[model samples]
Target: MDGVTGLDVHTLGIIGLAVGIAIALSFSLMSLVLRGMAALHVWAAAFWLLTFAGLAQGYDENGSFLSAIIGSVLIALANAAMLIGIAMHLGHPLRWRGPALVIVLFLLIQVGFMVWPPSQPLESAVFGLKSIFWDGWMVFFLLRAPRELKAGSLFTALVFVIDALFYVARGLVSLHPEMESPELASLLTTSNYLFGILCTFLLSTGFTLMLSQRLVHDLRVAANVDGLTGLLNRTALLKAAAPVLQANREHTHAVLLFDLDHFKAINDRWGHAGGDAVLQHFTRTLREGGIPARALLSRYGGEEFLLLAPCTSANVAVTLAESLRALVERSPAHYAGEPIMFTTSVGVATGTGTHIQRLIDTADAALYQAKRTGRDRVEAMVSDPSAGDRVNEATSAASALT
Candidate 1:
């Protein structure tokens, strides 16, 4: 292999090929393990395409036009695949027409260059511009990613920008080769191959980090959220509200416990599927009824939900509960051409302390009172100031109003 100073371009290419293959194999295995992540499969395919592109370009001893065209087209397709994978990862709709057009135009331009034998500088400029186009598109999308994935997305975008800068430098240097020393040109070529190997590894690592972050976030959400109603589960609600409750002992916090009235009867009349529809409908109604943003809402158990609102007074809590109850009563869940009307009984308790369980117990007592008096009503209880931090028993001061 010819050496550019102490560095060998051929050896760098060989190492890049090995590294690309290893990364591709790793992605392929990950895709198999994470079958739901479609982006991984696309990325794996992209790497394989890149490897083939390298092989096609490397073994073309005579610089044959066919081999050159094959290599160029394969590389363009590989980049296109990568862009598509990014789109998939971000949950964006795939639009392949533009990338396909770019590839076709690249192929046609390569054919033109082969036939007319363009100057080396012009060829390098065109190649570099093509790369910049794709890199710019990828950077745009990465920058537009959601804030939660900002770290990984920004790192990947930075790497792409650096790679694009290298291409720009290569084109600029090739443009005025007569002004530079032979050693400089050789060094640039060697540096290009070395950068290629390094960039490929970095890109792969960045993508894997992005994927791992997404996976961890999804796992956490799945663990905390109720699958049916898409609300926080009991344990999650309790865990999340603990800090809020403990933060300010003087602030009044309220817990609203809601029990759907006659839930079992709905299931009996409409089957389990219809009952599920009603549950979803109730959740939507509660959301649409202007629930406070600061409130922590969760499905506490079967046909029961709990909402913890910090800095809420007794009056505000009761009003919110009444509003939700009325909203649920009016909104009917439809299933199989039948409307299933349902209602809920609510228990509201307000206290000034970190005793969350005490507040919940007081709210549950109020809820029991509401159910006992009649279903589909709101009952409220407030802690007695004389009792200090202890949440007092349910009070009749704010009685269930029909």
Candidate 2:
């Protein structure tokens, strides 16, 4: 048909071949990276490859019923495997039992496709839909991922999206034309050649956006996290705290403050270099044990930390503060190849009509009280739940003990 028409079949074939190779290589590379990160990554990457492969093969001859059945089975299995693996990595990775469940779904879909088999011209649609799934995931990861790799992954995904769209458009134009031409043959052939070239240009632009997004994401992360400990830095903390401070101040919330005991003396004895090492180690320890889903952990200053847990009661905040203090005190400290012990003091205060600044002042007073009475303990201003009751307690204590 292409030969009878005045279309450049040679150029069309070359363009298609180039795109197919690019898509295939992308899958192989990404699959390798995903596999290194977690199991079933290959399944996700391979789905894109197999979809293109099916299109290239099916175009030769509408795959026979048996061939389509086999091809469909492979594609379905790949998709199912991808969904299962990603769901597992989210937490509670599925064992062998999961693959068994996924295979059942694959077999069911395989049976359906086998019965119908090549009823519609599915080549372009097959390629497009499959790429959309992978591309969606790539965009999602780019948004949420912690580092640079997230951006790189997106470039390949964008190429697939463009390939998928052009193929779908090509299919639509070939099947349903708005205007009828005297020589439909030449029109169809010429359009196919033109679309392929268009795809190449789109692919280049999409990749540019993908890489740019990655660079921006990485720079933002570097600014937020402390270089040594990978914890949020002081600047990051203040910015993060601003919203919470306003929220709790407007609607009564609790705050817990902590300061490491004898931190200065230890740093003075074992150089600032060793001090930094110890601090980084301590940050790691805190990060290891999971924090509350809503909790924000930030470094307030040197030797001081803030755990701002919103919508919490004063009593509960005190309990948490004490536990954190105990944990830090128990953690082993090594400097200059020698074991050293350290402890922290905590102060808890709840906001009612108090501003964030006033809350910090109250908490600081309680922290000073902890140090004065005995280090390595938790002291809370307004130990009672009722904010009004705290003023009464302070007054009574001052009058009698005065």
Candidate 3:
């Protein structure tokens, strides 16, 4: 095949090797900076293996059996590694058995070909079929990715689909060897090399973009979520609720404020670790307690939580609050195999319009009332004629207790 085209297969192989090595190095560096992303490391190793495969195939001037077998196996393994890395990135479970069986079968076929050398077209057909299988497998997974990763996933899937089409064409062309003149064969080889280079670069770029998108999503989550309870933070809750509140101005919204009763005592008795465990326990209870799907639940601050339920009535809000209080009271948090008794005080306020701050203030006043009367109780204040009357009443009552 040498000198069939001005830029020969060997030259293309060398260029591919150089490009693979460069990409491998970039992925390796990315793995270092993005420490926990195991996909980056896997992809780096895959590129290195692909480079080795290129080297094994490129220098085989005599088309040696050993070089052929080694190159085929390494190339297959590299493709498998790429699929594995993609699974890792998407948090999908790795099912090694299927991929392993495919690789073993592919290796056996390569070995069979080496033992009884077939025509060039037959060999090319086998290679093309194998390439198509792997590329198709990658496309399947990429297309099924979650909505959050749709952009990068779709782009990468499209690239793989194109690659599969190339292999399909190669296979079809190889089947009709009688139609392949010297000039046409040369053109196909040149096209293959150029397309191979293009696909390799595109695959790497697509993977990098996926990693970038994932990183951005993770950073955004970290910023808006409470590290301990995995609940939305105050800022995130406000940001999320503002639009909903404004959109449903005609509908009533309920804001429920909850303070864990005697939280400091729990910390004092069982230490901060125990306190953390209790907080987690409470969070789980809330999740399992049939909270409305559209409720905006957040960790307002230490030992304080807020829930904003849109399109809810005052009665429903108070009932929900009481249910939560009872649930918490009955469900004891265990620390060191001992049951740690604890409870929560809930204050609920319901109103129409987009005055989220006003609703929160009213809920705060009611929360003060709950604390004053008795901890572990549910108290509620509805929006009165002036909207300030209930808040004033609760505040005056709270002041009397003080």
Candidate 4:
């Protein structure tokens, strides 16, 4: 009761809750630790939160001095366990020489402090050293807590630093047993401790928020992107194209469609491995050094890509279509050191708020005509056969992607 009188009941309750939470967290965090990608947060949180409680309880207990030292050793073990768990999850090798030494020394000091209480004037330096070492560990861990450097390890270190710095400051205050003004010293010391607690709270909360934000962003990008081809997936492409189509009410637009000619033959000749290499390589070319950062490029289907050229004229669309055709003809990818020749028939259609579906249908017809006329040729869509006015066309060339 005498020990409890000096401590704020609220802080005591918080410390209790933190320890209870840590016990609950072990069940949840252990499973994730076994998995490769988990944050390992549940255990880290509980471990650190309860650690403060243990330290406070140890100091408060009127029992033998060794209890506090044992408590410190237990907390250090939890930190060590967290580091190992994180390294396993990341598949990163651990080199714990420096940090391990700091932890071992910390345990030794805690035991020393219990064995030799601070009531004696000669014990001041020992208390100060222990406090300083605790602060040192905190700083070291904080420095290492980024994803590239073991984020979980860094966060856990920061929490310990907070706890350690608080003790060090308290130890420093105790060293000056007689100050200029006892009341003033007490006020300043209390403010510092309160602020340290706030900083610790911020470190935990801040990382939690940051991690959640990153996870959400990654999940969203994965859902909307084609994992294999790295383009806007089918659904995302349509969703993006829908808005562009609706806005082209006053201007004519073009759709240039291209399908890789003799693609299946390459798969048959080489192998599915060769086919995949070809697809990935050819898609890079189709991107034409990357869809105009502003333009939308999408994989419409196997060996088929759609480029939506907004408010583009037939002449411009034809030129771009031919560009794509020429690129594909020249960029014959190889697998197993064998050059794999491939080509695509391109179709282009220009329409102004007339029929978007017709735009694609007309291009499809032209694509078919190109394939029918010759395997490696471009053909324009003729809106009226009698007039022979080719609204979309491929240049007369043997090589499609020049």
Which candidate leads in lDDT?
3
lDDT of 4 by residue, 1-402 (tens): 423434653465455546445543643564464343354453465356445535554433344544465655565555555454444333445566755786788767666666665553334446456545645644554454446444544565566566576666666665575643646444543464455445445544544543444456568778777666787765676678777878776776777777888888888988888988887887788776434444677777787777777777666667777777777788888889888888878876667774566777887887888788775666666443432343523343322434
Single out the weakest 10-residue window by summed lDDT for candidate 4.
Answer: 392-401
**In model 2, where do residues sit more than 4 Å from their true spots?**
1-162, 165-193, 242-251, 264-273, 284-293, 333-340, 368-374, 382-402
Candidate with the greatest TM-score versus the true structure: 3
Give the C-alpha miss distance for residue 193 in model 2, angstroms: 4.5
Task: Tell me the TM-score of each prediction against the true structure.
Answer: 0.88, 0.52, 0.91, 0.60
lDDT of 4: 0.61
lDDT: worst 10-residue window of model 2: 393-402
lDDT of 1 by residue, 1-402 (tens): 244454466677788889989998999999999999888899999999988888888832245865679888989999999899988887777799989999999999999988898776787789899999999988988888887777888888998999899899888888774725666657776777788789899999889987987798789989999999999999899899889988877898999999999899999999999998988888888877898998999999999999999998766777778778877888889999988888899988888889888899988998998899988888777664553323322233234443
Candidate 2 vs. true structure, TM-score: 0.52
How big is the positional error of residue 268 in model 4, measured in Å on the Cα after superposition? 2.7
State the displacement of the C-alpha of residue 85, model 3, in Å, after optimal TM-score superposition.
1.4
Error of 3 at 111 (Å): 0.8
Question: Could you tell me which residue pairs clash in candidate 4?
Answer: 22-46, 145-154, 325-400, 325-401, 326-400, 326-401, 326-402, 327-401, 380-392
Give the Å shift of residue 363 in candidate 4: 2.5
Cα shift from native, residue 219, model 3 (Å): 1.5
Native-referenced Cα lDDT, model 1: 0.84
Candidate 1, run of 10 with poorest lDDT: 388-397
Show where candidate 4 strays beyond 4 Å: 6-212, 289-291, 354-356, 382-402
Q: What ranking of all candidate models by lDDT puts the best one first? A: 3, 1, 4, 2
